[model samples]
Target: MYDGAIIMESLRVGTSLEAFPLILRRLSRYAVKTASADQPPVWTEFVFEVADEHAVELADALAEVLDQPGWYADFHNDEENFVIYPGRVFRYRRGDQLARAEAQEHGRTLGVPEPQLDWTD
Candidate 1:
């Protein structure tokens, strides 16, 4: 099932952050297995990066969001370095169009394919 299902369940019951991890754990029970090496379970984490030039502001913003439960790291390979859960990943982008553009640039630099963009008429 998609993460939306888990989120919706949480929202319906008014879950708190303290309780979010437990909900995530329960959701993991229903996760479908992939062909990855070990078929890791699903959990959530926040992935982020900032240019060395903007490190300070990025650090401050990261600090502000750290209270939320999720792993944080700068390097993509380092993500697999820690296993609080399995098959968990989240990418964070600073708000606004400029930030979105920069994220696309960074993704390209990392050899990640650009995501398809859609606009509703």
Candidate 2:
């Protein structure tokens, strides 16, 4: 299973994520507290599962929809990890520290806070 989580708040204006048929198998929602005035105090995260075969489609969709300003989506399967930012997607082996660092650095360059750059490997 390809498990991933997306914060509902991270979506860009006028953009809606598609509920890919037979791809998204499960979903869960949770609230995250934020102090920024630009965002709601409680942000809802939509955690989901997808079939591994749809990784490319998922990455492409996420790359297009994630906001350009520091927003990203992370998902992983048994052997690979995907880190997606607006207009960009990074694929790395499960345990590649170098690739992870590169992705994190890219996030930082996008003005993503260091804490927000934390994504499961």
lDDT of 1: 0.28
Q: Pick the candidate with the highest TM-score.
A: 2
Q: CA shift at 63, candidate 2, in angstroms?
A: 0.6
Can you tell me which runs of candidate 1 are displaced by over 4 Å?
Answer: 1-22, 25-95, 116-121
Candidate 1 residue-wise lDDT at 40: 27
Cα error of candidate 1 at position 58, Å: 14
The residue-by-residue lDDT of candidate 2 on 1-121, one tens digit each, is: 7888887777888997676743444454555443234444565666778887788898899899887666789999888899999899999998999999999999888777777778888
Q: What is the C-alpha RMSD of each candidate to the true structure, in Å?
A: 13.8, 2.5
Candidate 1 structure quality by residue, lDDT tens digits, 5-91: 221211212323231222232323344232123222443333233234443333333333332222222322221111111122223
In model 2, where do residues sit more than 4 Å from their true spots?
22-40
| Poorest stretch of ten by lDDT in candidate 1 | 78-87
Report residue 99 deviation for candidate 2 (angstroms): 0.3
lDDT of each: 0.28, 0.79
In model 2, residue pairs whose N, Cα or C atoms come closer than 3 Å (at least 3 residues apart or on different chains), thus clashing, are none
Scored by lDDT, model 2 comes in at: 0.79
